[model samples]
Target: MVVAACAAALLAGLTGTAHAVDNLPPDQPLVEDLQSGGKPCATGDDTVYVPTPPRLSAVLYDPEEDNQPSESSPLSGEFEAWWTDADGTVQRRDYSTITLSSGSRQYWTMPSDLPADTVISWHVRANDGHATSPWSDDGNGSVCSFVYDDTNPEQPTISSPEYPTPDEVFWVDGVGVYGHFTVDSPSDDVVSYTYGFLGGPYGTVTAERPGAAVTIPYLPLTSGPKNLTVRAIDRSGRSSSQAQYDFNVKSGRAPVARWKLDDPAGSRSAAAETGTPARAGIGATFGGPAPTGTASTTTVALDGSGHGFLTPDTSATDIRDTFAVSAWVRPAETGRTMTVASQDAVGQPGFTLGLHAQESGALWSFAIGGARLSGGAPETGEWAHLLGLYDAETGKAHLYVNGHEVGDAVAATPAEAAGAFQIGRARGTTGYRDRWHGDVSDVQVHDRVVVPTEVSEHAWRKPTLLGHWSLSSATDGASPEQSGGTPLHLAGGASVYRASDDSCIPDIDPDCTYVPPPLVGDGHLALDGESGYASAEGPVVDTGDSFTIGVVVRLADSAPAHPMTVLSQAGEHTDAFKVRYDPPTNSWQLVMPERDEAGAPERVVSQITGADGGEGPGQRLVVVYDDGTDTIKLFLDGYTNADATASLPDGWHSSGALQIGRGTVGDGWGEYLHGDVDEVQAYAGALRDEDVLGLGGETNPCLC
Candidate 1:
């Protein structure tokens, strides 16, 4: 009846827009997704085991055609959520219907003052600047309805790993980091634990009973760093707040030449590795000091008004055919001509690397080139990594920003012979004599060519680094390389961070925190078509019956070429009922079979779905059969598409073991499902269309 009432309101235009279907719904704004716990109703259609008036989520989307407007639309729009009160009257909730266009995941829940154990039926509608969509309906043409479960489980205490722990960096051993946890609850019901690396939506373990020590098994790890977070969930579906652990998997390489860049003023220099006497000097007045809080590194700014740069002492071996140049830079302002580093000889044998602005101040233009090769313009950013490499043996030049290769690079013009090296400004000898205006730090140079992997490894500051300039702290104008080989003196007074940092916060501590967030990955479970199955005892619904099945399925191909089964149950081929998907027509059928006189099973009554195929992907599809109406219907997303009369006959009893992802006939398996089917659920009673809508979004609670 609630479903019928919701459909009546929709068809009567309660949500505002209504369009005929011989085709698709009219192009209008609509709620693309709505759900709870970032998941669907895990228990069944009408009841969500979780507590509260219940948290509701809705994401709005506009017709693709109307999205790119010439004139900007209103920044925020109105969203209305109305519900039926216990007194049998329709009332609107007090939650604000307003949200900005840039807003994400609008949410609403029953007021804290509301009583629990009450049956609530609610519907939602979204209004873009232009118009409102039809009252939001689940694919079943009804609003979201559920009985509230307000009592939450006991708060679980995390016992392992030990809190108040500082950050650490290291490689993953065979045994990945381990976490052990336990939850204690008063109810006899079992509790489950969900853990993930990073922010999350993926559950490493969906439902595991609580134990004295709950630990996550190790899996192949990703290349970069990660944080791990975990939470506890009781049988009532309530989840405890999470505990976080921060750490990184980084390389351990020794740098060649180090420059603690902490020189305040006087003479600025970069020392050569091999103990060569050649060092760096101040070309002009050093300026532009960047204040970084993390490691409190040294920073200096230079204006393009003059040829401000560092004069390098010559060492043929240290400045040879192969080169790896890297640094951390932050532009004070963009769009102006700026050069950060260069080694230009009197002839065309050397190279010059610099930043350029596009047509506007906001855009960036980066390029690097030698006599014969050039590549890459980095994306404009306040702070970014800049890397330039040239290998004479390979005759190739490469440019990179943030570890990603930038354009197609060409041959390098052997940079071996004796030459002058400069920083912050290019050599005045070149035609492109550009002075830089920005902050620069941690300049490193290697005499040998490093591979791409090696370069990426350095992105996190790996080992065996040749020449390094940490550009950190110094007593007066003197700053020695961290390796202590080359010592340089600062000429112009440069402002920089003087505070020491904790060694535990390793790598580059740009954004360091006591407890960082965890790293998360894709959370979907892939099922192999042949062997995947989840089975359970189903609710009994005899002769007078009402059953509903809501599915979120993905096709195995662009167009499924074979039939696949979703749910089924059978006994000796005499008692059977199943749901089949036909690829040819992109149709869903709720089929019931009976044994004929020939002793073979034959189709008795089948309600074929009129829903079209390739509605794109991740669309919620529902098949509902209500004995009261003697009919079965198809609902897509949340709209009723078609219906069939008498999908079930008299004395239809479906009391048997339920098998998902495949069907069994005569004790043999057939009609196995391919592709993925998530949040597949069934209900003994009818479900409202709106309830189906809330279950449409993909659940990834741990995605960060």
Candidate 2:
């Protein structure tokens, strides 16, 4: 049904060099006449020919712009192709006639089902009733081409967190969600990704190497639910079906509390008590309860006796036992003596669990028998959590509250005792004499030592209201209620709104509306201030690698260059370290004051800056530093636009405060960061360019 047409110019037996493959008919067209560039084929004489195209190459279905094929071949079509003596002119010829489409190039879309290893063939003929002549012998240009196969071809894959969860009580953990995508084909095809709620935000990630996968982290701030999707694409811009998932965001995880037994100058024993002291103390009423706009409140009425203790149950004391002691307390009045936990002997000197006045009354003293542990200098009317840990092996005792470590002390080994423990009073005499003057609740004691590292690994210590209280007129009016402590004050005129009776806006303020007193035992602090922006999230970082750290910062122009900083000890020892950017430059530079090859601190870091130029109120800046290569770069809105690098100092030491929003001991001091800093982080390694670009796309890594 196909027809071949050749012009009279074809009858010319002119020199072979004067004839072109385009002069051929439809049946024996030149390979150059075909639109498909890469394929293998044989000529009428059974001569093999390869196809090639300029500015492009054959590739596997999954082609990356950086990949190249090994074989070279021309495309296949019904006729042979050739160019006329004039530039920009081409012709095709067959056995009977020549067919040509001058000034028109061939274009074809490969079939999706094309075999991975198949090759195409093309034929050529002379338009002037002459057989196609050899290209090398004929001064005329012949079709040049190349071939391609599925070698090193990659499959369309998705990147994301292995497991994602939503809606919970707590959420601050290093368990991030990220994925790496790659290809196996070495085609010159370009690769990209499409992502969204239904798997959109297409063309977010691009492939540089055939099999190199790209990974990005995911963390949601809002405590809710959301869906996400992602897809892969090839050089031809063809996209694959999207991968999808449902993600839930919740208050991070619970803070972990570890306890160890430390002091006890001498052996201690428990006394037999009548009414269970552990259960008798002011009803367990100490903890952060939701809807209170604050941690729960407790009431304590000191009995005639000036002592209070939460005694342990009989058989509660055992050898090599690990225990945890927690109490929410508020001083009823200045210099008032109150014991939240204690143990006593009816007829002898034994271990006593309770707090006592320091020789100067400047701070409450934690003690067990003749041994004294460390305590904080709490305000006369402030609420606080006084926790204690006693480990016998390392003889290390620690205290923490709300995820921050307070101080440490050493103590003797704990032995088993057959007596009952007391609660809400210093355990001394027999009668209901020593009743505590403050409320105590959620008291738990495990039978083993809780390590400091273990506490760092868990999240529960982070406060979340899981309980409630019923306040009677007598209980609310007569007691130092929840309002008794140092009132939390916000700065910048930020007003604190009660999300509930126990919770408040987790944002910022204009003035001091929230003054979160140190909970003292835990080694961390949570903002008990007005919650702003309706979301609260923090960054997860690893400090082992060099890093540039930055926070979404607002500066007063007059502020110094480095407004905030974070420093970590190189290792177990307090030496060798790196410095990360805090704001503005938001770029990380290595400032290793101590570079000990024997113990050189491998620093890993991350930073941030304003996306929009500085002059505005809420611009964000990102800073980054690579310790391995000592490279420094800065980015606005996750784009690396600026960079600088320098040699690190030798013999650096990191045994200092990991200052936040301010420097530890230099240039930027007392300079409280102007803008709100959310999601601060440090990394253990260097981040790639694609990773940075990926963060800027509509598909945010932190999105749920």
Clashes of each: 56, 191
Against the hidden reference, what TM-scores do the models get? Answer: 0.29, 0.30
Q: Write the per-residue lDDT of candidate 1 for residues 252-299, one digit (tens) a residue.
A: 233444333444554455443332322333433333353332232455
Best by lDDT: 1
RMSD in Å for candidate 2, one decimal?
22.8
Q: Which ten residues in a row have the lowest lDDT in candidate 1?
A: 516-525
Model number with the top TM-score: 2
lDDT of 2 by residue, 464-555 (tens): 11111111111211211133421212233122222133333335544424423211111111221122111111212334333433333333
Residue 39 of model 1, lDDT score: 46
Q: Score residue 549 of candidate 1 by CA lDDT.
A: 57
* TM-score of predicted structure 2: 0.30
